[model samples]
Target: MFGDIMGMMGKLKETQKKVQETKERLNTVLIDEQSSDGLLKVTLTANREIKSIHIDDSLLQDKEQLEDYLVLTLNKAIEKATNVNETELAAVAKEGMPNIPGMDAFMK
Candidate 1:
């Protein structure tokens, strides 16, 4: 029984290490998302920080529309970033513990 407990502890430590490494790798990733009209685009890091933005010159003439488009594009970018983050996190959780029931729920 003691030996089994020790082995489980070791495996848990290994999983923790792998999870940390996975998070670091995810942090280095970037996701790009854009608006339907191609007038606005945004880049976000895995940590959801806005890394950069782009705007087409054609939208400059319409300030109101440009503002609306900018907001829409930014929302799209954020949504994409969130989806990517969730997917990556799920992958990491599965890789770390495929048999651990409800592990992801606990992690979240």
Candidate 2:
């Protein structure tokens, strides 16, 4: 019983290390998303911080349309960043704890 407990503790430490490494890597990754017409684009880090935005000059002619496109593009960028973060985190969790049910949820 004591040996099993020690093994589990070691596994937990490894999982914690993996999660920290994943979070650090995510901070450096970026995702880009664009509007349907490609008139607007947004770039966000994996941690959901907006890095930059691009807008076509033609879209500036109409303020309302430009605003709408900006919103849409930003949302798309956030969604993409979230998806990438989740995928990477999930991979790390799976590698560290393959049989632990709801390990991902527990991490959060």
Candidate 3:
């Protein structure tokens, strides 16, 4: 019985370490999306921090069109980053969830 308890504790510690590592790595992961015409581009981290933007110089003369392209590009980048975030969270879940007395039944 004591050995079984120790084994479970070891598994729990390993899972916690993996979860922490995944979260740290997520901040460094980059996800990018561009407008359909490729005039605008946006890059963000997997954790949704906007890192950079690129816009064609030709669009700068027209404020309205520039705004439209910016919006479209940003939204696409956000969507992509969100999908990446979900995937990362799921990977962490597959690693193992926080240990609780009775949560395993519900999590599975």
Winning candidate number (TM-score):
2
Model 1: per-residue Cα lDDT over 17-75, one tens digit each:
87788678867788888889777888888768888889899988999999998788888
Error of 2 at 25 (Å): 0.7
Off by over 4 Å in 3: 1-13, 98-108
Q: What is the TM-score of each candidate against the true structure?
A: 0.72, 0.79, 0.72
Please identify model 1 stretches exceeding 4 Å from their true place.
61-63, 98-108
- Candidate 2 lDDT over 1-108, as tens digits, reads 999778878988898899899899888898988988888888889989888888999999999999889887888788888998998887776776646666667766
Q: How many backbone clashes does candidate 1 have?
A: 0
Q: What is the Å distance of residue 90 in model 2 from its true position?
A: 1.1
| Stretch of 10 with least lDDT, candidate 2 | 95-104
State the C-alpha lDDT per candidate. Answer: 0.79, 0.85, 0.82
Model 2 — TM-score against the truth?
A: 0.79
